[model samples]
Target: MQNAITELEELTLNGASRSFLKETAKWCKFLSIMGFIFTGLMLVGSFFIGALYENLPQTQAMPFNVGGMMTGFYLVCGLIYIFPIYYLYQFSVKMKKALISKDNDVLAKAFEMLKSHYKFIGVFTIIILSIYILAAVVGIIGLVASS
Candidate 1:
């Protein structure tokens, strides 16, 4: 176990790959910024939904306060999006620092953050797929009933 741990610690990016890592870090930073901006837009849109809902005429009110539901859903999605973006941003920053200083420890930590970013995205994707499958099943049942 100790030998395995030591061998893992020895794993490092080749010097030739430094440029590639730098470019990847740059792209990650850009994408992270865009993600944060989109999350902010989503958060703002959630409030906009609530405001729109409040202004709707009583006659237009949806069957289960769907407007409020939309707002809540948007807010939750924005909040959930924050975690992956933050992890990616941290990875970008740490990766840059690691490359600059040639610090293996920082590089490892950056990779850990990258792993966390992917883990969050993977789990979210699974959840979304499940939702899609459920919706499809429900739609099929509705179609069968209508027939």
Candidate 2:
């Protein structure tokens, strides 16, 4: 009877461990999705900003003020940037747990994706900042030339 009880306890413990692992995997998947979404949205926003600038009438474009757009864009981008960092932190925790459980495959996949995500954000920032600086320089030159 005692042997049977021990076996049952072991089974129960194993079940609980599996449940924990399942939850961790779900979180990993969620983080991956969020990373992809953030990257996509940033690219889309860049396109929208470009289109808006191109569509504006040149006559009124000289005194363009993006105070409102700049405020909102910065707020959204700030949140987007913070999210990946938070995800990478969470992934490190999850990967540690996975490694202890001998789930090295999952750890490898998650960290690989996390690394790619980090690079994606870096590229997005470089492109966006370049465009923003170029626009400002051109605008300043135009203002000075007109004066």
Candidate 3:
């Protein structure tokens, strides 16, 4: 029992900073899980959209069937867009919890910064990926039109 108390003290006492890291770790695990689900849905949607585009006629935009499918698909994609946004909110909530608990202010601030940095990079990557996919689609269309 003494050892347990000692360990808990060491865990919380190493610095308020360490506790903040723990909080970030806890929240990031959840955000990462959401990211996984969103990415999977996007991958599946991309395949279906690709197939639909393949069947499209020249001079015709996507048909009602394809557009309808994509409309539903993008709604889920938008949810994916917000999945990481939830991480920002999670960071805010955890920071507040740390403040209310009178824990480490420095570490709490660091945790917020860390999550924001990750979120920024992730959003950038998503944008780049979207552009690449667009380019690929255009390339495929050019090839089909030429052939």
Candidate 4:
């Protein structure tokens, strides 16, 4: 393990690797910017959801405030989306700076941000998959009970 760590520490980026990293940083910046814009749009759209749902006849018949619930849902989703996007944005900016200046600390920080971004996404994916599985099980149980 120590040998592996030493080897990793000694590893250096070649010109090709640096070029690829620079290109990746550029793409990350573009994607992060797009994500931020969409998240902002989603948050803005959340406000309109209440108004839209208020006009629906089905929602009107419901005892609960469907509009408010939907707006809150959208807002929560938008807020949840911001973290990974911000991490990605930070990774991109830091990576570009690190590459340009050949700063090891900055590069490490940039990679840390990238790791955080992926980790957040991975955990989120697992949670979503778990919810899907739970929903499927509940649906099957409901169908069986009805029959």
State which candidate has the highest TM-score.
Answer: 4
lDDT of 1 by residue, 49-132 (tens): 987877777875466876788899999999999999999999999999999999888998999999999999999999999999
Model 3 regions more than 4 Å off: 1-64, 105-127, 130-147
Candidate with best lDDT: 4
Worst 10 residues of 1 by lDDT: 58-67
- TM-score, structure 1 vs. true: 0.85
Clashes of 3: 0
Q: What's the distance in Å from true for residue 31, model 4?
A: 0.7
Q: Candidate 2, which segments miss by more than 4 Å at Cα?
A: 1-71
| 51-123: candidate 2 lDDT, tens digit per residue | 6766666665455456446546755775667666565655656665665675656666656756766786788
lDDT score at residue 136, model 1, on the 0-100 scale: 100
Which residue runs of candidate 4 sit more than 4 Å off their true CA positions? 1-5
lDDT against the true structure, per candidate, is 0.92, 0.66, 0.66, 0.96
Worst 10 residues of 4 by lDDT: 54-63
Model 4, position 16, has a per-residue lDDT of: 100
Q: What TM-score goes with each of the models?
A: 0.85, 0.43, 0.39, 0.93
Model 4, residue pairs in steric clash? none
lDDT of 3 at 83: 52
